[model samples]
Target: MGRIEGKVAIVTGAASGIGAGVASRFLAEGASVLAVDRAPAPAPGTDGARFDSLQVDLAQPDAAARIANRCIERFGAIDILANNAGICDYRLLEDTDDATWDRAIAINLTAMFKLCRATAAVMKARGWGRIINTASIMAERPYPSLTAYTASKHAVAGLTKSVAIELGAHGITANYILPGAVLTGITAPLIAADPTLRETYDTMGVVNRMAMPEDIANAFLFLASDEASFITGHGLAVDGGALLKM
Candidate 1:
């Protein structure tokens, strides 16, 4: 039987990259998925993967409530939640304007906080849930031109931990995953613009190859499954040893 055969999951940022991989994997493992994204529904793309879709810009104040509500309306329960929607703002501290900082925090950290707040309530009522958020290698290690992104990611670690603690008594678990340099929808264009960047990222980690979306998705699958029932308030690093190099 599939690990999460009868579970229902809500996966954000489901249009592309790591989000797409997670959605596809979860479906394969027998879970019904409600995929969320602002760009589009299942674009970039899980062409044949069957799943429900919601288009909502996470930056909106009421987006979180809407997402949680939609998942319930569509699937009846939210057994797993993957707060994977985020943006990577590449700007140095000096070049980062107020708008840039605020936007990054809104998408990367604040939105997660709200969604967790909304979903956890439902999970508590049901007495079972799994919350897996996407932090970054930058969550623990900062880098040049990624000041805003780094700060927001760092906050994700603490935000998730607090949720984990608050929900443990409710048969709920919360954790975040730290992804390293991965070839994704967001990074593909960046690498395309500069072919040299391909090699640079491929070699950033000890593995000597860039991580694929599936690599991160694998971590998500584990944390969401019953296998990780005891793993709460933890930060799982799916980075290919990239943190060591950083």
Candidate 2:
């Protein structure tokens, strides 16, 4: 049997990239998924199993509640939540503006907070849940021009730990994953512009190659599984020892 068999998971920003990868992985592990994203759903010819798709921009004030409701409607209970929706831009602290900073907070951190608040109530009532937030290695060892992303991800780590402590008594687990230099379509264009740039970025992590989406997804699968019942209030690094390079 698959590790997460019969579970129901909610994955945010799941139309593409890491979020999509995690959703696909969850399904392969025999979990039903409620996929939330602002992007359009995959088309009819898409080559994988389907999920119940909810289109909502997470930056919107009520998006979290809407997703929580959709999850309940589709699957009766939310066994896991993968808070994987986020965005980043390369701008130095001096170059970043208030609007950009606010946008980053709203999307990367606040929305996840809201989701946890909304979903936790349900999970608490049910007495079981897994919450996995997507943090970044840059949250601790930051780079130039990444102030907003770094700060938001730092908040994510704190939030994960805090929630884990608060919800543990209810049989809810909250954990964060720190991923370094994952290669996605978002970075594909940059690599196309200059292939060696990918290699340069790869070397920033202890591992010499960029992490694939499946690599991160595999970790999510583990965190949501019964085997991880004892793991909570922790920030697990799936960064190929990127912290060591720092």
Candidate 3:
């Protein structure tokens, strides 16, 4: 049997990138997934497994609850919740407008809060649950032109730890993953636009190469599995030591 056999998971930002990669992995491991994204339809992955998809903007107040409710309505229970939706803009701190900050925080942090809050209610009742939030190396470290992104991700890590502490008694564990540069469709254009970014990307992580989406997805799987039951309130970095660099 697969590690997640007979389980049900919710993957946000599933249309592509890490979200899609995780959803695909979950399906392969025999989990039923409700793939959520702002995209209008089910994303391409998993070799034709017919997982459900919900398109809702995570920045909206109601979107998180709605997605969680829908997952419950369809699957009757949620075993895993992966908060992976995020947006990054190329702008310095002074150049980042209020609207940008608001939008980034809303989607990257607030939405995850709402989903975790709602999902935890059910998980607590059942006495078992796994919550994984996607953070970044920037959460602890820094980089240019990612002020809003870094701040939002930093908040995600804090929220993950807080949730873990509060929900541990109820068997709901919350954690965050810090991924380095991962090769995804989104990054393709950026690299294409400036080939030099590739060199920078290689140095950003300890592995000295851009990571594949599957690399991070596998880490998510490990954290969500029973093997990690004792782990909580931690920011697990999958960044190949990128955050450790001075």
Candidate 4:
């Protein structure tokens, strides 16, 4: 039997990138998943009745409640919540407008807060749950032109730790993953536009290669599994040792 057999999971940003990868891994582990994203239905990596899709703009005020309701309606329980939907804005502080900053925070940080709040209630009631958040290397380090993204990710780390502390007594675990230079759909275009960018990221990691979506997925699987029951309020860096650099 799979590690998470019979569990019910909710994966946000399931249409593409790391979200899609995580959803696929969950289904393979025998979990029923409700895949949420802004894209239309038919979320990638989903199959049959075990995997359902919900189109949602997570930044919306009602999106969190709607997602929670859909999971309960479809699976009757919430076992795992993966907050992985994020948007990147490439702009320095001086270049970033108020709207840009707000939008980044809304999607990257605020939406996650809403989802956690909605799901934590259910998890607390059940006395068991796992909350996995997707943060970036920027969460701890800085990069030029990523002021808004960095700030939001930094907040995510703190938020996840807070959730862990608050929910640990209820048998709930909250943790975040910090991925570095992952080659995803979003970054593919940028790398294509500037081929040298790939080399820059590749060299940053001690492994001398950028991470694949599956690399991040593997970390998610480990944390979501029962094996990680004691691991909470931690930031697992699947960054190929990039953080070691000065």
Candidate 5:
């Protein structure tokens, strides 16, 4: 039997990248999943797991409630929530407009707050749940032209900690994953266009290679599994030791 057999999970940004990887891993572990993304769901594959796809902009005010309702409707209860949908606006503070900053915070930090708030209620009622958030290596380190992204991610770390403290008594664990230079939908195009970019990112990691989506997915699996029941309010870095250099 799989580690998470019979669990119900909701994975945001599941169309591609790390979100997609997490959804796939969850399905493989015998969990039913609601795969959500702003893009239309992809054609169903032969993963042989219970998978439902939802396309919704999580930044919308009603999106969190809708997602919670859909999970309950489809799976009867919510066991896990993976808040992974995010966008990055590469601009320095001086270059960033108010709209850009707002949008980044809405999607990256605010959406997470909404989702966690909605799902925590469900999880609390059931007395068991797991909330896994996707933060970036930027959550702790700064990069040029990423003022908004960094700020939002740093907020995510704090938010995860707060959720952990609030929900620990209710048997719901809240933790955030910090991933470094993983090859995702966003970075794939850049790497394809300029091969040198791959080397640049690889050098950032002590492993001397860019991280694959599955690399991060492995961390998510552990955090979401019962094995990690005692772990909460932690920032697990799957950054290939890149932060050591930072």
Candidate 6:
């Protein structure tokens, strides 16, 4: 049997990038997956035996509730919750406007808070759960021009830790994954616009190549499995040793 056979998972930002990758992996492992994203529909790697999709903006206050309800309604249970939706603003502090900052925090941090709250309730009642949030290598280190993005991701680490501490007694584990120089939907356009950036990322890590979404997805799969039951409130780095130089 698959590691998570007969289980159910809720994966946000599932239209593309790491979210889609995670959803696809979970489904392949025999889990019923609800792939959530702001896109009208998610069409990606999730061709596994059991999969579903939900379209909603994570920034919406009611979105968390809607996603939670819809997943339970369709899949019957919430075994894994992956809060992977995020937005990054490429601006220095001086160029960062209030709206840009607010949107960054709303999508990256606040929305995740609501999602954890909504999903953890059901997980608690079920007596077991795994909650994984996508943070960035920037959560601890930093780059030159992404103040808002860095701050929000930094907050993700702390928020996830707090959630883990509080939910551990209830058999729910909360952790965050820190990715570095990943080639995803968000970064693809940027790299295409500036091809030089691609080389920068490719060589940024000691492994000498930028990471693919699937590379990050594998980490989520490990954490979601029963093998990781005792692990919680930690930042799992899937960064290919990028932090070593940072």
lDDT of 4 by residue, 1-246 (tens): 888888899999888889888889999988999989998544444457798889999989999999999999999999999999999979888999999999999999999999999999899999999999999989989999999999999999999999999999999999999999888878899999999999998988899999988899989999999999999999999999999983
lDDT of 1 by residue, 6-69 (tens): 8989999988899989988998888889889997756323323336889999999999999999
lDDT of each: 0.90, 0.88, 0.88, 0.92, 0.91, 0.90
- Candidate 5 lDDT score at position 172: 93
Candidate 5 Cα misplacement greater than 4 A, ranges: 43-49
Per-candidate Cα RMSD to the true structure, in Å, reads 2.0, 2.0, 1.6, 1.2, 1.2, 1.4
Give residue 69's error in model 2 in angstroms.
Answer: 0.6
lDDT of 4: 0.92
How badly does each model clash, as a count of residue pairs?
0, 0, 1, 0, 0, 0
Distance (Å) between predicted and true CA of 26, model 1?
0.5
Query: Which tens-of-lDDT digit does each residue in 130-226 have in candidate 2?
Result: 9999989977788899899999999999999999999999999999999988887667788899998887778977768889999999999989988
What local lDDT does model 3 show for residue 68?
A: 83
RMSD in angstroms, candidate 5? Answer: 1.2
User: What is residue 100's positional error in candidate 6, in angstroms?
Assistant: 0.4
Candidate 3 lDDT tens digits, 1-246:
889887889999888889988998888888889999888545545644437889899888789789888988888889899999988887988999999999998988899999998898889888999999999988988789998999999999999999999999998889999998988766888999999999998998677888898999999999889999999998898987787784
Ten residues in a row with the worst lDDT in model 3? 41-50
Instruction: Choose 1 or 5, whichever is better by lDDT.
Output: 5
Question: What is the RMSD of candidate 3?
Answer: 1.6
What's each prediction's TM-score?
0.96, 0.95, 0.95, 0.97, 0.97, 0.96
**Relative to the unseen true structure, what is the C-alpha lDDT of residue 145 in candidate 5, on a scale of 0 to 100?**
95
TM-score of 5: 0.97
